[model samples]
Target chain A: MQDIYILFQVAGVGIIVAIIHTVLKQMGKEDIAHWATLIGFIIVLVIVIDYLSRLFNQIKSVFILQMIL
Target chain B: MGSILQLFVIIMVAAMLVIIVREQNESISFLLVLLLGIFVFLFVLNQVEQLFNLFQSIVSKFDVSLLHLDTMIKVIGVAYLTEFISQLLKDAQLNSVAVKVEIVGKLFILLLALPIFISVLETLMSFIPQ
Candidate 1:
């Protein structure tokens, strides 16, 4: 349920970051824009990594991976 | 019907958004696609679990070895995990890496099938003169 919102959240972050980058680029702050992009990427990564781990864990348990290992 | 329609709409909208934003930020668009992929998988997970439950019950009724069933299920899981990863790699323009991941996945499925393979070999060997 709550998981679905994560898609929109990532999308929002991406769009917002893009706007920020474009704005900074116009001001000739390429270095700051680069930093902003990196920070946005990290933020998205942080949000996604949590769900990815949980999904993998669920997959493992559902597949009875413990028995195989 | 309504839920399916809703899912379709959401997916369409999200895809369009990703396309529009892709020109702006590569990393973020990649993450957006990743999130969308995970969300859809999670959305259908309940139905898949139900199907597996039904499969387990039927297998139990037949007095079949649950170990083999477990291995088969795990192989399926490996396939799924690999596809998830390989697709992400491909999305990131790493086609060779994606292919390698797929190869590794096949190898893992083979490893998991070893016991079953041996069982078949033993059955065949028993049919020959000892």
Candidate 2:
């Protein structure tokens, strides 16, 4: 529910960044466009990485609980 | 689901038209087709999750360890995302870069699965009374 929403929000940012990069590249700003793409990727990675880390912790806790039980 | 089918048909028709137009020049038409594929794939992204859950449920019916299942799913995700990124790089004419990224992705996925592999092996070994 909320997770899907957050995921979509992050995906939307990625789409926007890609569009901007494409447009900039078309306008002959290859260097700037590439840098922008890199930044966009970093931003998306940061958001997704946080979620992944949380998921890893959840997986760890669940495994621990199962073992203890 | 019906809409996805419809979109696929539309893309097919568009591709046919592009082929016909190839006599003029294919560069822009090819780009359009590529964009069409991306847009359609994005539109049906939700269906993919349904497929993943279906796979998870089927896999869970087995006696396999959850750690192995999780590792497998993560590896599958990594493979899919790496392919997607590599394809995009290829589209941008960065084939070498795509190859490098794919290698890195494979290494990362291997690292992620190493722990699960070791645990499974140890569990199997202990079962043999060694």
lDDT of 2 by residue, A1-69 (tens): 124344344445555666787799899999998788677666756665565555434433332222311
On TM-score, the leading prediction is: 1
Candidate 1, A27-68: lDDT as tens digits: 999999999999999999999898888777777777777754
* DockQ of model 1, rounded to 2 decimals: 0.75
Supply the DockQ value of model 2.
Answer: 0.05
Please provide, for model 2 over B1-130, each residue's C-alpha lDDT reduced to its tens digit, 9 standing for 90 to 100: 6876777766676556546534433333334344444445444445655666776787788745555666666666667557766886786578999999899888978887899879889989989964
Fnat measured on candidate 2? 0.00
Candidate 2: pairs in clash? none
TM-score of chain B of 2: 0.62
Q: Write the per-residue lDDT of candidate 1 for residues B71-117, one digit (tens) a residue.
A: 78888888888999999999999999999999999998899999999
Q: What 10-residue stretch in candidate 1 chain B is worst by lDDT?
A: B39-48
Estimate the TM-score of every prediction.
Answer: 0.92, 0.47
